[model samples]
Target: MSRRDFIYTLSATGAALSLGACSADGGSAIRFGYIADYNGASLLAIADKQGLWKKHDLTVEPKVFVNGPVQIQALGTGNLDYGYIGPGALWQPASGKATIVAINTLAYADRVIARPGINSMRDLKGKKVGVPEGTSGEMVLNLALQQAGMTMKDISKVAMDAPTIVSAFASGQIDGAGIWYPLIDTIKEKVPKMKEVASTEDMHDHIFPTVFVSAAKGKAERDRKVMKVLQEANDWRAAHPKESIALTAKLLKADEAKVAADAAHVKTMTTAELVAKTKDGTVDKWLDGMSDVFVRTGQLKKSPDPSTFYAGDLYTKAAAR
Candidate 1:
């Protein structure tokens, strides 16, 4: 069967099989995948569960992935229309393949937790630190090390995903780590001696998770739709933080307190407000800080200009709306 025939067959099969199919404008449908380890990233869940996409004339079939890299890979391959996730996974795509449509949530919501005997950054030297490679958690940890006049070389770095890092910590294989909620909260509760030593605080305006909504292949126009959906969702979140928290927490299977804490960490910004902040070079300062940490630690070959990767069309449209 041809690709079109296959899509039709699949859509029919979904309808017949009782699984929902993608909904699109005037007969167009789009697949939108999300990560299930929601934590505070469940803004999409709230929008989805409440049928917000339908109100926008969209048939976004939301699927869940296990991690950011997988979710982003799906986005890059045309398997997803759009999703909310951290910008760290956008580096390669931002180089040429895709553009970040908008900022989602920017909260440091990430912190570094150390073992009982590890009391300071100085104590971390020669100790093992576990982090999911290429994640904001790791990025924050790298920044913290640099701020303390140290590098990853000063400590043994264990590259693993969130679950693995947690397991390693539990097994006493890693001395400390930079982690996000609810795992961060879970770890603290489970490990009596584990303590948070630092967070994304004092990083200037860089304290929130900058979510990216990527465009599908040959779908630049759809980027506008993604942005609109995100803007509406953000507005909903702002007006109903409690409802957002309850719904998101239910979907993520996390506690209300943890979800609320995560929400509190996010100082939501309007698209226009974010652009204005960028105009004043606050984003530049944040990226510069990120670049400095990467360059100093050899994560980046050189400090590239931050502006090369940003796309403001979505923000511009959202502002106009």
Candidate 2:
């Protein structure tokens, strides 16, 4: 097979991923930076609550950021040994320099809620929608519109975070809004007229949701130990749900009740499941679908090789033993 094709093939099977020629010998302490938002924060919480670092013979320091962009910037600066973030946020940085190492969470928890009178995406035309511009919600909104044969230009894309979106949506500043849960739940309860119109689930398959990526040059890439630790952490979280939720609440400053509710919605897969699904037809379908949407929405210049951005070996080796 050609080099690119070979890489894609191996990535599909979870084997023979390309790695730099250095050893990851001494880097045992890993600094995992994440966002305070639900998804990113949950990952760190899972690791800590499950004692994943101890299980893997490593020390993990989790740092919280405000958003995906800031988290990606931290990765690029060597401030983070690893992190979880929305796949949409990685487009610019991955194209520029960074490399995504593993698929952390394949299922996206983002949901779109529209006011009662607004039933279909067609109704969104000329309506105001709240989303953090250049975020996963915004990207998903673009895709949802495309699926309906529409575009962002068809509606007003208002820039706001989840909290602001919640408040504005309540006051009718926006006709529709996109946010993740418990916010989605909270908003729906507060605005009884609001209803869910679309969700990441409606898109059909995993859109890589949020991924685990490292900088072009981080110890996670060079050290097998670091990779093993991360894998063990994944395994731990897969085994411990309650503790993970509690830790998640502490870090997010959210209620334990809501944190538990969110945990049910977050389907954290094992390293083995990730390796298998990503290796076969599953990951191919996701990447192809994502590429189509990105190209359609002008998010990408051209179709670049998605496999080039992945390091399948770490996940592969972790799964092997």
Candidate 3:
């Protein structure tokens, strides 16, 4: 895509999150890929503010994409050294375009926002629902629908980027949404009549897992070092939620209040917490959940064994040090 097409796509997602600027480094530094939303790359943004990259002596450049699929496509072109993607884009790794160097943050933070008079998930049948394709938003929507004894077939599904979803919901163009912050917060601020019909918080069996992806060929040890920095940042964010939100708002050029609203949906884990989760098979299970959604959504014909692309053993070894 050209610069104009790229900018337009990013804006349409409604995150308006930018990683500042990039350089013509010519392979001098790692071209780090991240989604252009706080939800997409919040961990890395926090690490950047915390000076973890410099502390680790790792050179990484932030390249912003509208969503995980775009990020994965860039990864395939030999541009991005590594990237973080939500469950919606997990198919990329399952197909061998990239490898999961580290199981990224795991969470259950999405909610269904509906126009008033729609009191519960059951009411969504035949109603227009907007969600970004392959997003945790969609994952949450699917689970929420299942809870109501329904599926995507029950609702009029409209695939949109987060920004477009926000616009449509705010202007009464759509009936509901399965989107995350800061877009969710935007709807709350602008559309007073909107009611939250469902939250992933109530779904114990569902998890929105994202992972750090490297090109199909990546340095195992080096990726672990990068994972170390991310885990440290994750731990730090867990300990300082308010500061993390403030820093994210400043970084995204977004409102502090809106970013703060996102805390309810974000769950940051410490290294010990991650170490524990990794050992218990929780990470593997979530990876399965991620890949399963793509197949159910008809994005992938077959999802490779989640373990086939997972490099979590390397993460456990890194944490041991």
- Best by the lDDT measure: 3
- The residue-level lDDT of candidate 3 at 280 comes to 92
Q: Each prediction's Cα lDDT score?
A: 0.62, 0.64, 0.73
lDDT of 2 by residue, 1-321 (tens): 211111112123211111212223344456665654445666555555555555555666555443466666777777776766675665654464566666666646677779989998888889999987556777778777877788889998888865678779888889997666656766766688787777877776446456666776645434465556556667766787677667666655566776676556566788778788767857556666666666666766765566666666555775676
By the lDDT metric, which is better: model 1 or model 2? Answer: 2
TM per prediction: 0.81, 0.80, 0.83
Error of 1 at 104 (Å): 0.8
Candidate order by TM-score, decreasing, is 3, 1, 2
lDDT of 2: 0.64
Q: Could you give candidate 1's per-residue lDDT for residues 147-248 as a string of tens digits? A: 788887898888888777776887788999977765665566557788777777766634444666565343556666666767777777767778888876
Task: List CA RMSD, all candidates.
Answer: 7.3, 10.2, 5.0
lDDT tens per residue, model 3, 1-321: 221122233334223333224323322556777764445556776877777766666656666776777777787888788888876677778878888877656655578889988999888899999998776778778878877889888999999987788779888889999976555656776777788898877877668776788888788767877888888887787788788777766655565675666555666677788778888988877877767767776767876676678877888888887
Better model by TM-score: candidate 1 vs candidate 2: 1
- The best candidate by TM-score is 3
